[model samples]
Target: MDIAEINLQSRYVFRERISLMVLLCASSGRGFQVIPTSGMTLRSRSEHHLSNGDKYKDNVNALLLVATLVATVAFAAGFTVPGGFSSSPPNLGMAILANELDFCYFLLCNTLAMQCSVVAIVALIWAQLGDPELIHRAFHLALPSLFVALISMSAAFLFGVVATRRSHNNFLFNVVFNTVTAIFFHVMVLLLGPYVIPQLPGVPFL
Candidate 1:
């Protein structure tokens, strides 16, 4: 063949190979488009297994109920002190142990317990009614509030026991009860306090 004809044939063969390559790449692209990507598949599976916030609602409600009961008892204890109320005019039927330090401590703890318990209950209720984000925030707040309420309630009970025993003139009994109460308080604070309180955001070290 002549040089011109040979050159024209080579050019035609090169064009055909280029066209075939382009067609193959286009077909491969379309094939890949037909299949779902890994990310899409993962997202779809995740949606199918999405968590429900109400899964723990029953547990939280039970805790709140118990806390409310403690609050009620604490509130009632404020009115019914260890010793009977005085009938004097100036005091106007106030508790006889009102001026005593242990009695005062009991009153302070009872008030704190009642307030914290109420706050915890409110937070839990709001968590049940609010959005997911709010629920998370409320739960964090409620846990700490409930912890404080429990500790304060326990302290109030201990103080009340001490005050009552002292008022009855039982010196040995008072010492024994106070020692046991102190041990119990220390155990509770050491074991549970650190675990519960530090989990809360912005909570200072105790």
Candidate 2:
């Protein structure tokens, strides 16, 4: 081949390699569209864990869940009372149902609303950091709780697109409570201080 022809072929190969590297980096850097930053294939996998959408369909598990709720006064007042003999735990139900009129306030600040706020906070941070995959994975640590918080409250507020606090406790109260909690918990434990999450059985930090 002529010298010029050989030079042209080399340039083509170099450009092709550069293109592949760029694509790979883009995918790894952004993570996933779920957070508007997950552009890389590998990063997406890190954000979604197998536990994110697991089914809790076992009848015994369901029964235990309800029993636990009924026993909330006995259990979680201390935040760790499975034996029912522990000191009176904070009554989560009471916290949840301050007044029939104020029920939205309690649930929203405590559940779904709180969750959405958390996701938004993390999403903001993720975006701010130029969307790193590691940050996305750290955020995933709270994904399951965030999802439950939303569904539980949404179901409670059946007809209300969002609960509003005109005269009664509304959606906004909960939205702030839950969102702030999520952001704080996830960012503190997973993102900023992963080592802080306790390895104990029922601790809630993680």
Candidate 3:
């Protein structure tokens, strides 16, 4: 190579070395160096993971509380059934409206609610073991179980009320039935409408 070309190449190499030295010096302090890009990325990932863990814990705690409450109420309802127990010797200790269709529905719904809540409780307990993958799977199971428990509990309440009411209180029964049905519909819409609305062609907001 010519001297001029070699001189130019040397200048370029010197400039690159200077730039690299400056960068290195800027990154190094008295006793420590700034984190490299890979280190920063790992730190950010750790932070994100911790944040997700906290969020999962919060969700589990809230759902656990709700499941516990539902289980408690359903257990109590099983013992003190609608219309109370029969006092007569022939049918003592039996639910008074046990033969009624509405009472049968109430029992079925209550049992479903209790079972679902118990499942949710168990799933949420598994979610607390501090493993991200396990926590995610547990939440998947717990959320649907909790939702079903809530729905079943509401249905049980409605059926129990109906079974205990007298025919003379027809107006009151209608009011109660309408109120509960409306509330159920409202909740279902709030929970499921987002998923359902987009699937319908030309449908507006729910």
Candidate 4:
């Protein structure tokens, strides 16, 4: 080939190689120059982030609903009481079972459930504000409070049932109460097992 033709071909090939290197560096993300992402990539990343945020909001909303429901139930139970209100002159407006140990326990547990549920509801409301730091803090507070509320509500239910029957020593009642207590504990252990038993080396965290 003529010298001019050879030089022209070499320049074209060199330009092609340089262009390929620039593309390779950009794709590998190790280039000296910072390459701006394409419009499609940025858009996809934004959509993915938005989807994740939406999912987080949905979860918070569901938890808020649960907390609100628990709070409402507990509050209503406090006013309704286990054995109704006394209409007598000496103990007017007091609970009929106020002196009973089971009724006292029921009231205590109901109070705890109501308080915890209120705390959870407040925290979850704050979580709805969309601040990442606040959301993290609110989640930590709300989840534990919600768990406590559930446990306390179960305890209150058990105590209320016992107080209503007025016979703790009945064989059938005893058997049913023990069975329910056992089931409650069993469910709790199962719920907590994944967090407790997955610390071993080859065990995956749930």
Per-residue alpha-carbon lDDT of candidate 1 for residues 124-181, written as tens digits (9 for 90 to 100): 8887763555555666667778878889999888888777664567788768876887
The global C-alpha lDDT for each of the candidates, from Candidate 1 onward, is: 0.63, 0.36, 0.65, 0.66
Query: Please, what are the lDDT tens digits per residue for candidate 3 over residues 50-133?
Result: 554554566668879999999999999899898998888899888888789999999999999999999999988987876666
Q: Which candidate gets the maximum TM-score versus the true structure?
A: 4
Compared with the true structure, model 4 gives a TM-score of 0.67
Tell me the lDDT of model 2 at 65.
41
Candidate 1 regions exceeding 4 Å error are 1-52, 166-171, 199-206
Candidate 2 stretches greater than 4 Å from native = 1-112, 159-206
| TM-score per model over all chains | 0.65, 0.25, 0.65, 0.67
As for TM-score, the candidate ahead, 1 or 2, is 1
lDDT of 2 by residue, 90-185 (tens): 753333223344344434434444445355345434433433444445344433333444344434443132333344466776787678756756
**What is the alpha-carbon RMSD of candidate 2 to the true structure?**
18.1
Count of clashes in candidate 1: 0
The lDDT leader among the candidates is 4
Per residue, candidate 4 scores C-alpha lDDT tens digits across 1-206 of: 12222232212243443343344333445324321111101112233334443435876898899999999999999999988999987999988998999899999999999999999999988888875556656766777678778878989998898899966579997997889898986797566332122122222221
**Worst-scoring 10-residue span by lDDT in model 1:** 34-43
lDDT of 1: 0.63
